[model samples]
Target: MKEKWRLLITEKNSAYRNMAMDRAELVSISKGNTPPTVRFFTWKPRAISIGYFQSLEDEVNLDACKNLGVDYVRRITGGGAVFHDKELTYSIVIPESHSQVSKNIMESYGRICGAIIKGLKQLEIDSSYIPINDIIADGKKISGNAQTRKAKTVLQHGTILMDVDVEEMFSLLLVPNEKIRDKMISDVKQRVTSIKHILGKDISFNQIADAMRIGFEEEFNIELNKGILTDEEIELTNKFEKEFFSTKEWNHRR
Candidate 1:
């Protein structure tokens, strides 16, 4: 059996640094320089992150994001755009050869997201995994995840909604048509929920992190020893942030 996984509770950071670090960790793990890692982090100044294949203009209101001081970045993983405010984000990197990491995407989502569902359950929030990459409670989405595989390493990261600001989210994210924006907002309100909504009160970030930690430990039967980013990952992240995530060429590639 594999030994303890590395767990990092990182300080809040800019959108560019967060995404850069995620890819850096993946690179480090793939090269056998770091252990499988689980990292929990938050965004500073709030942010919106889009998937690798998304069209920046088509999916986001760049002017609104800039005007409101909300940072935006493109993830290396493929998925829809996500508003990252009032949420806890987690990223896990494991090699393909790990017993817990599955070869199939759906199967991998099932196993990785199971830890999320289990964690939510610990909070008295009854939730289930909806295929592809979502966790739902009372038939509404409470979490969304995305994954990318590279160099025989899998990087899976997701958002755990602490609160949902439909209006703010809509302001920064584009609707299919301006005319139907209201309807879209209404639909999203009905379909999405958060920890505060389910629990009917605010939950501290550390509280949620603790629950998630136990969930992963219990579900995967692997201890997550607290750790920090290695020197190699930090170096890579610094380089990638400047060359990739901080550049318009990468974010607006589409």
Candidate 2:
């Protein structure tokens, strides 16, 4: 018998809501109140999300985000700042006791990212996982991922770039040295790419989601049952959104 997992595919939402929902799911699963889940979501009005340990002032330009009407939030996971636009974002939450999850962070990352690698292959993108975390194609990064373990559950989330606008992304983010900003941008352009660029065409969000769904099922030997969030998750998400993600006390807490 195949194991069963919950699958949530959500519509585009504000950055705060998305972050809150991801956290809520992690908490629910960790506490044994909900089943392990795979969530797919998108950003509305665009957004920039920085890692938990990142400094808002040092890593992002608040003025740029505000002036551009872009939402910004801090993720519970650790990684560099990422501009979330024109991408497919997915998160996985599983209890630590799950037989498939590795206690070692690097091994866990590899195991989890296998789904992404398989998904990219299904799309014919020819992607590979770079040790630690990251998915690359044609020697350029096409996906960025981050993970956190808390309350006995592991939450791993990431963005699969459907398209990239390096210039626009740079405008909203900061570099340590202003003098080297241009160089950094150039370097990133050479090292990062997107699905559209790789395939020379546009792909719909549903198509990407479908590929990832199949990837996860194949990698884990499980069947995903499409599910709606429980009432508890919804309530928790709202509370977190209002009390934490939407407040500077949390987003800028670094």
Candidate 3:
């Protein structure tokens, strides 16, 4: 018999709620109140999530986000800023001491990303994991991941692009100089790709999620029993959202 883990297919939510839920799951799993979990989610109204070490004002164009009715928040994990749109974001929460996770950060990244690479393969896209947390396909990046460990638990979350809009993304991010904006956008377009771009047609989020579910299961050698957040997790998410992720103090703490 395979060890069973929880799977959460959550509804699309605001950036605050999404980050809060990720943290909440981490906390709960750390406390042994819930099984190790894998969650699939998306951002509603779209959003920009900057790494924990990033300065929100420096990384994001707040005026553009506001004008476009998009949300923005800071994540607990460390990575570059990301525009959360037309993507399926998945997160895994498990004990850091678990046999499957490595003590070395780089090794852990490759181990976890192997699951993502397998997931992309399910979509019929050939992909490889690049060191330090990126998945590339056909010489272009198709996924980017970030990880952070806390309270003896590991939380890794990443985005798999279903479609991409480089122009829209660049518009919401800051550029060092207006003169280089066009060139930077052009460079990114050459480097980043999506399922639609690769397969020559759009793939639904559900389809991608299904593929990822199998990918993780196959890579981890565990059964993922579809599940929901516990009441404790919901309460924690609400608290975290109100007191942390949604607050200016947390988002602007840089």
Candidate 4:
């Protein structure tokens, strides 16, 4: 008795386009206008996404991001800052009526983390779930997820590190002082490790994507329909692209 799913795969999209599409998918699914969607996307030119409630002037070094030519956007979900390089990003949008859907944040997080844990297990990583949203292997985080539930739909998305540039991640995120930055670097070093770093080999992006697809399908017992965004989603995405995701005000709001 597996729930069926539809997929949306956008290999390389601009930061603006990616965010816009996610928003549109959320609305479409919430309204029961679209099926559950799983999307894989990567930002072209790379970027840093701030959490929705985060303050731009306070949480990021805009000047450094600009100097580095890193585009910036604020996500509709809540989470800490993340560097989106060498990572495969997934966005899952489910209708509120889905039996597997969770209104409680922790419940939803656990299910998704369970899926991620299973995915990493395929790579022989022996991963497990950590509270407050993470997939950990050997006590180090490999994935981080965030979610937004509104008007009867849920949009959950996260990052899986294929490789990490530790120094660059620390540089882009704003820290009150050098001491905090140093401490954070140490903390991330202690707490996070990429799959490539742990495996001592590079895993193809497709391999990870398949792992995720299988994990989620097993967890939800759903027959996923491998596909892309519909014409309706595309039309709505185009509208969102101009109205919300690319705006400066949206990027900076607390």
Q: State which candidate, 1 or 4, has the greater lDDT.
A: 1
TM-score quality measure for candidate 1: 0.98
Model 4 C-alpha lDDT per residue in residues 69-100, reported as the tens digit of each score: 88888898999888888988999888767788
lDDT of 3 by residue, 1-254 (tens): 99999999995999999999999999999999998899999999799999999989998999999999999999999999999999999999999999989988889889889998988899999999998899999999999999999999999999999999999999999988989999999999999999999999989989999999999999999999999999999999999999999999999998
Q: How much lDDT does candidate 3 score? A: 0.94
TM values, all candidates: 0.98, 0.98, 0.99, 0.96
Strongest candidate by lDDT: 3
TM-score winner, 1 or 3: 3
Q: Global lDDT of each model?
A: 0.93, 0.93, 0.94, 0.84
Which structure among the candidates has the greatest TM-score? 3
Q: What is the TM-score (0 to 1) of candidate 4? A: 0.96
lDDT tens readout by residue for model 1, 94-151: 9998988889889999898999888887889999899878899989999999999999
lDDT of 4 at 11: 77
In model 2, pairs of residues that clash are: none
